[model samples]
Target chain A: MFDIRSSIINQKKYKVFYAIIPFLALFIALFIGGVLIFFAGINPWKAYNYMLQSIFGNIRLFSEVFTHFVPLVFCALSFAVAYKGGFFNVGGEGQLYFGALTATLAGVYIQGLPAFIHIPLVLLTGFIGGAFWCWIAGILKIKLGADEILNTIMLSYLAILLINFVVMYFLKPANSYISQSEKIAKSAYFPKLIPHTQINLGVILSLLTVIIIYYFLYRSPYGYQIRAIGENSDAANYAGMNILKGTMTVIIISGGLAGLAGASMLMGTQYRLTPAFSPGYGFEGIGAAVMARNNPWGIILTAFLFALLRVGAGAMQRGVGVPLPISWTIEGIIMILITGSEYLSNKFSTNLIGGRA
Target chain B: MKKSKVFLRVFVLAFAILMIFSTLAMTAPLKIAIILPHAITSEGWTKSGFDGLMKAKEDFDIETSYQENVSEGELKGALRGYIAEGYDLIIVHEMGYNDPTLEVAEESPDTMFAITYGFKAADNVAVTSGTNWQANSLAGAVAGLMTKSNKVGFIISNDSPVAHNFLNAGFIYGAKRINPKAEVITTFVGSWSDVVKGKELAKAMIKQGVDVIYSQCGVVNRAVIEVCEEAGIWAIGAVEDMSYVAPQTVIANALAPTEYLVYGVIKEMVEGTLKGGRVVKGIKDGAEEITFNPLLKDKLPENGEEKIMKLRQEIVDGDITLEQMQEELNKQNIKF
Candidate 1:
């Protein structure tokens, strides 16, 4: 009994060490990025200074950062939820498109509804659209023995074409040159969080989602079942945890979260559905999930960091003369370092624990 | 006490000098920045814009910079970054940038924003597009006259019908004018970079007896032209002089003079003649031109170039209205 208790304590220490790896990895990535910038004959300090300013200098710029952040938070949580159950849900992009398209259709067609009813109804429609699309992949994977990864990726392209066709033929506004649906009713739009800024209720929704996801993943018994399946599905099945139910539930929830990102984007800022509006936000969410090491709180920080990089990259080009490609290079380096650190730390922890045992 | 008094006097002089110099800096040559969806090295819209910006920088003695491969989601942030960096003008080099450009323009009233291939403008933003129809009509006439099969193919990079209506309709009109029985088969590849798709579509159209292709894709146009080369058919270029890639297969280019448009706008900005509004430059403004490949100089059918040049003149003289072309598109029910 004492030995088992000691082993449990050691496992807690291992968890703490794993928690610090992401930050350490991030530090190394930034350091390498600084070195690359230095070799290019610019002051890395000036580059970072510009990024910091865009993120926190003024209320407006800060709000812009959040505008980028809101969609990303939803996407990361989408990927993270499925990831926790050992499912690679690569359908975030497709799910986001469906969500936004459905929300736009709801916002444009459904008239005379009150603001309270209309907004939630639009959001719920978006969630259903994304969930339904993802559910197709889930059903295929479960019933037909298809790979979810390949099915999800393929569905993303179909979703893009579907949205394009709908916008071009069905929802296109007359007298408008671009292929986009008409603007939603004012009542359907998310109320701005800060007057005169793009920051909207979507920001609050994302935050609430983060907390709710945390509780679902860590505090709930269902979360425990998911983790058990993730660690070892065969063992989990042997322990009588219904693997099939867990997989379907996590995938549906994951797709729904990503769909919410589409809602936040259309309702909060775009206010109209345009093809390519999601613009790879779903893929970027996967990057965020990887950077956060699949931790919900970590995803928030990583998503904000990506926003800062995006906004600051332009400034770096304008102010410091760093080419736009260099910014992407930095982003790639950072992600590689983060994932690499996570791998090495896990290996080291495992070896250390084995030796001590 | 004496040393402190001297230090105060020096500090005051320094502050006054700094204020005077900063004011001069603001009134100096305007700083310009451009954001593009693709690399400048690509032989298409981005290249022409980059070349124009460079020429304007030289002619006007202005400072300039650019960021490439900026997506729609990142556009607002890029514009804001340029504004925060004190750039006087920002040129968005794609149509997809219209909404983002306008959003940033409203937020930063002091910064002047210019967009190529956009139709909307504000007090602080200017939108401009090259005449897609003028040169395309001329090129289409050439294709119609040259085709032995009386069938021609049209491929575009999936711009909205509202945006490319003139080009699409004008091609049909110019072709049907010469050969009323000419069957114009149109296809949208949905992307500028999908070379494989472009090639496959061109092949399918060729199998359908399309002997000439009016290609409007970006990098993917090369694939279309290559397919033409293999099949020993003729192809027309869009926006850029693509004859350099395959002189044997390409006959004439329907030029959308993006460089001329961008250069004219930047020059106006330097001279303080630039204003916020839509400036739709077409054949009259020399915003559209076509270059015949010298390799195909001897292969011209009787009056092919003559007919195309005549139509070009008519377009420039305003004898042919965009409304007329749009009507043709409507009659054919061409989907955007």
Candidate 2:
């Protein structure tokens, strides 16, 4: 049997190789993207330059990119924590919706509270709501041997339906015509960091979250046990680690992080909950987490890149008359290339080491 | 080793050069961008707006482009790009774009921006929305007059102000106008284009004794119509003369002609008659109107055609204002 676990964790050379994998993957993806441009009746080089200029050419565009990066970081961190404990938490999107929904409710209902108390309380509601949602999935998995992926996906749909029901039946504002929750109180809002831009303190909080999660993952004792369980459940069991407990803890933490992401949208950006408030941040978080291989710092970098691409794609659509769907195509191609590069690098390393042996 | 290094360096350099050239080639003339909330292929509701822009482009003689499936985070970048490229007008559809549109408008004061919904206006921003509720009320009144079962159904998408104020409220109010005893059963699918759910809800309503359905849920209207057709019941259409979408079952339609609004705005812009503020287009402005199916035209109630035509004239003549219409409906205990 292949010693995959040892190869992944114990090898210093493999660590260095994996460290460069993401960049190599991106480089290769861009090259493949060039060919796609050629087929689209556009020169690949010019398309990429336009894309780059749209993202990083000006302060306004850069701000737009980073603004998107804020929520993505939170979402990625959410997934990274669950992934670290060998649990696939796909309910991030639903958890995010519940988080925003609960936060919005708290913000609207709880009045007369000071800004400091209201803001933290609203955000805490989101964290608790998301964690509670994830805990359900974890509990079901542990108690009933239910598949986390299927249950989480179903829960996400349920969460969406539940939010719709709440918004329509309870949270809708007076005289409002739509199915949206009432706007949160002014005191509950996240303060803007920039004068004219939508960029808020949430970006700073997300970055802080990354640092905190990184510390919790690598520098803390609990992190060690989680990693150990993730590496091998049988070995972890032999070593006196409770696999069920670790999975539950990680899922809750993951869901909490994702919920915080949703809260950030309510507090920092939207200031209200609508049916379409989230633009699939949960799915994007998965991409970001996978791209970074669940590393906290790596997730930040990947999330930023994803944000840059998203922001730049918008610019491309506006400036160059390129359709928005083309951007999705570019993203899809990049993801494929990234996966291909990883496979290629692994094969190359195997051959080189085999020859040496 | 030197040869391999040289090859790699040259390849990288060539790739960089290609990237630079591709970026330059993408620059276009007279860039006009639109940011839409949903995918273009989603049909009817969003596509109609895109179609209106495409129609406007024919007369305006400008380069038009649109971004579909745009979320709040992407709106700023899309707007910034158009502004940077010296685009004259950037039209954003969907209410969610309100805050982002305001932010982008403030950021780029030079760019002329237009938003489809909402009354909030800035110096550089122009707000345009129709009296959708007025049209929807008309359709509801028609449903009230036409339904034989005394039970009418309404399929709503989301419980947004846009839907409730214009479509749902108007529908209920209209139904009650002609028949006070009529029961209006309302169900919301929670999505703008969920045909499956829409069909399910409509079927459920029909099963509960609803004979006529006023679909106020955009693309999901098709599903409601489908259910109506299958059940062989009467259904009212809104937003466009969606009577054509399900001709056999659709009895009438309340039209919110977005193209008319887009054309009117562009024409004003061309004539230098456009200004910054909200423009509320309604029946009086020929923005909202009702279209009855040809099959049902002669079959309407004895004086129904004359009554509706007289009401249209009264609305156009300003003898019956939207406020007056609301008051009249309110006297009837209709909440539209």
Candidate 3:
């Protein structure tokens, strides 16, 4: 209920309240995270000191955070776009694997081409692969009245198993132990920006995508149609919009965004596909999407926080022997507090204005 | 313009705080670190490595830290993080860490590294390359002597030359040495943890009249042993003492002590004799050997224990060598 519609109470005051929610949630969650460290018999101050130093002390270490952030951004956008269009496309994990599989095939099997040609072509294949996989769930939604949330979640497992089988049985090189595909072509690589660091063109691509997606959703007439469908599908239907076509389009775009995430990861960091290659990046993006309130620009910030927490988890382990789960605990707390605060603030504002109270 | 000035002030404060903590982190002495690919509580390969790390920490009286359950995707970054923290020796405790270790080692020439199950090496990297085949060879000899059906089975973790030379070819070669009529059957499970596939493979081998089986897959080893127990047959355990899993079924337990590999690297580091190449140790160095299960001592087929023990001694005395076994593998064209 504390969505964009909350602006009906008082737009300027609501803006200030929404803006403060993330920082307030983060601060409270980190405080709780310190309590956890205290209970675990670790010096909470020392644990936090190490975490902060590892995250922001040096340039390369800081840049490494973006390595995880890039894939998350794509996945967050994937969820955000779909959520805005009145769909819960929770199949980002499957869509990502589908993209990575197709991208791997294209990158490995295709003949020599210029970097310019091959890169875009590989990315296109990834998008098509993810979009097509998600389209199955979308079609089921409109035609068979299937719940996409259940379908996408289950499809993730199936997608992972199928990709593993294909790679293990077919694409694995001789004299190898792990289930992984052969390395992709060099031409398809997202060019690295720093020596011995994973900072690459993927970062630029993600930023560009943020601005583009933001503009499309807020500025374009088509984006308004998608938002309208989410607000009231029957009203959208009465508005003479083809609800089926509009819904399917949003789902496809959502899946394509996640597919781009897979492609970026493949092109940026991992040059090969392996079983469970994502490390739950797709699932994490849902947290980012929800925490960012499905805003394209806000998703970037939330994704960065997710990346920092993961990196900080390693720092805590390395610096003070804090277990890896504490950072994850902090992330879970942030999501919960953000949701709770948003709800509470919405109710407070409604009560103040005597509009919905 | 006013907001920009405030942002600049906060940035400077944050940077200053970061510098102090980073410098504080740099004061550890002769630190050794281990990077484990799986959870230590898994009670398998990763657990053995952690035990060795602790043993090294105690024996050498040196500072040691470890990071376990690190995935392959994050391996490069994890390795770099340790190097940045100035760990002198980073023991990468998995075969999957091979490629990433090579890359990180190339970047940091001063830092020493020991990669368990790793293949390639560089200027500062020494790999834990021991001969598990020696133990497999001896187990093959014992299985050959014990089997009445003249069929022995080896359920390997995967199809590779390492698995072949270490777990299969040496197995077949030693079986024929003791019983020329012994037919050694080998099958690949394509995974170290696939219980169902391992179970199916064990059943199929049992159907083929194999009364004695050697299974090298990790969790699948338990599955195979249980199947053998249900069928009232014999099994050979690998890597560690697995007799308690099924006392009657596991007749002989073959151990290619992976802990020794870890201990050996720490020893070399202390002795200032660590070199960048394959460190091949086996029965002679007490890194590989076989232990017979006492629960099945009555089923030892009279002097079966002696014959296997003498063969192990011959291996230790250098009268029998892994090179000879490697040649046998070549002659048999049994490269997986």
* Residue-wise C-alpha lDDT for candidate 1, range B1-336, written one tens digit per residue: 999999999999999999999999877778998888877766677788889989888888798989887776667767766776788889999876677678778888998989988978999998888766777787778888888999999998885765367667778888887777788888888987888999999999999999999888778788899999999999988888889888898998888868888898898888888899998888777788877998898898877778878887888888888787777667877542
| Model 1 collision count | 0
RMSD of each: 2.8, 7.9, 7.4
Candidate 3: residue A36 lDDT (0-100): 95
- TM-score (0 to 1) of chain B for each candidate: 0.92, 0.84, 0.85
Report the lDDT of model 3 for residue A176. 77
Lowest-lDDT window of 10 residues in candidate 2 chain B? Answer: B24-33
Give one digit per residue, the lDDT tens place, for model 3 in B222-335: 899999999999999888899999988899988876778888898788778998998777877788778989878888888888888888888888887767877866887655
TM-score of 3: 0.82
Residues B1-336 of candidate 2: C-alpha lDDT, one tens digit per residue: 999999999999999999999886564334456778787765656777788778878877567778887875456667776776677777888765676688668877877788876557788888888866777777777888777889998877776566655566666766776677788887777777788888888888988988999877767887788888889998888777777777778888888866676666666665667677888889877888888899767767888866666656665676645455556666877553
TM-scores, one per candidate: 0.93, 0.84, 0.82
lDDT of each: 0.84, 0.77, 0.85
Judged by whole-model lDDT over C-alpha atoms, candidate 2 comes out at 0.77
Off by over 4 Å in 2: A1-45, A105-125, A165-200, A336-357, B1-32, B61-63, B107-109, B179-181, B243-247, B295-304, B317-336
What candidate 3 gets wrong by more than 4 Å, as runs, is A1-15, A140-143, A175-179, A339-357, B1-28, B132-236, B243-250, B306-336
